[model samples]
Target: MENKQRLIGIVLAILGASFWGLGGTVSDYLFRHQNVDINWYVTARLLVSGLILLFIFKLLNPKLTIFSIFHNIQSTIQLFIFSIFGMLLVQYSYMASINYGNAAVATLLQYIAPVYIIIWFVLRKKANFKLFDLIAMLLTISGTFLLLTNGSTHNLVVPSSSVIWGIISGLSLAFYTIYASRLLVKFPAILVVGWAMIISGLLMNFKAPIWQFSITQLNFANVSYLTFGIIFGTAMAFFFFIKSLNYLSAKETTLFGTIEPVMAIVASAFWLKVSFLPYQSLGILLIIILILTLSLKKEQER
Candidate 1:
């Protein structure tokens, strides 16, 4: 039974990561070709995906009340913080990065979240700065430098705005990972994620009013991409990832989640005809090694 469950988790993790990766590519297409507004896109994505997730949650666990997370004052505050600073910020920054750059670079940049997690732990005195941690940090810095500069200190391969947004996305993701884990101890993953998405979506509406925006390039392809991004990319991706946690350890799940950037890079290359310089490719390899090293270290420690 345990082996079967683990097998299911492995499949779910791969599918979830693949969806997210391909979703990034799809988002790139929309932003570059479909003339989709970033604000409107993020707003609609959150609202629609949140609604779909909540519907699934209700169907899967009808006895559990979704509102229970709001019963406590502290939990309510944490939820709001998670929604805005973590969920909303991650989503917006990621999309902005993709808009400014390509999906491959954006996804690779976001993969540096584990480095931030290491730094946070060190600062909190929760963990010591070990040799592996130092190596991971160096790898992250070097990889990012190569990726941004493409091995040239004199020039940047990507826009400065894209790098900034990508880094912010990584930071927000680190926060999301840490804080969401805390919340998950008290609430189900679906409930917390669903509410977070809805809360963030509602908050975003004040700034970008999805109802007021107009898409001039509305076509079948655009609509299909949008629908796929919302349904498969956002809703199903989150659902599958969360469900995988039921059968696998967090470390295992995250290790599999690295497939996200790989998929994004491949999809961007073929589907969008994006190209990476040789040095940038090396940087991507280093970053992947860094992630694997950190994940393996954590697993060994456990």
Candidate 2:
């Protein structure tokens, strides 16, 4: 039973990671070809995915009401902060990066969150910086330089704006990873995420109304990509990732989740015809290894 459960978790993790990776490719397609606005895309994905999650949660737990999170003032404030700074910022920054660059670069850039998290821990005096942490930081810096320069110090291969947005995405992710830990422990992932997403979408609608999109502007292909992003990428990906925690340790889950950037790079190179220099590829490998190392937990830490 234990082995079978672990196998199931592996499957879930793969599915979740692949779905998220492919979503980046879809974002690349939408931003490059379709006349899709980032605001509309973010708002729609959050609202629809959040509503679906709420529906599924209510279906699973008939006695637990979805409105329970709103009853607590502190929880409500936390949800608002999470929705605005964590969820909204993360989504907007990631999409903005993809809009300005290919999915491979944008995805890899966002993976720098682990490095940022380590920095935050060290700064807060919550963790003692060690040799492994030093190695990870060095790799992160060197890899980022190579990724941005693509082996040429003469010029940046990726746009500066894209790199900025990608860095913001990583920063937002790090904040969410640390801040949401307590909330996640206190509440179900679905409940917390559903409310946060819906709230974010609704709040953003005031400035960039999602209801203003014209139906004629959305053809079949455009609609299909958006549907895949919102359904498979946003909703199903979150579900599978959360479910994998039932059988896998946090380290195992993170190690598996690293597949997301690998798949994203592959999809971008093949589907979007993105090419990288030899040094850039080396940088990619180093960063991936760094992420894998980050997943390792020391005996004391664990």
How does each model score on lDDT? 0.91, 0.88
Q: What is the per-residue lDDT of model 2 for residues 142-184, given as tens digits with 9 covering 90 to 100?
A: 9989988977879998899999999999999988878887688
TM-score of model number 1:
0.95
Tell me the deviation in Å of residue 62 in model 2: 1.2
Candidate 1 — what's its lDDT? 0.91
* Model 2 ranges with Cα > 4 A deviation: 299-302
Q: Write the per-residue lDDT of candidate 1 for residues 19-126, one digit (tens) a residue.
A: 999999999999999888889889989999999988998899899777899999999999999999999999999999999998999999898998898899999998
Best by lDDT: 1
Measured by TM-score, how close is model 2 to the native structure?
A: 0.96
**Where does model 1 exceed 4 Å of error?**
1-3, 213-216, 299-302
Worst lDDT window (10 residues) for model 1? 293-302
Clash totals, every prediction: 0, 0
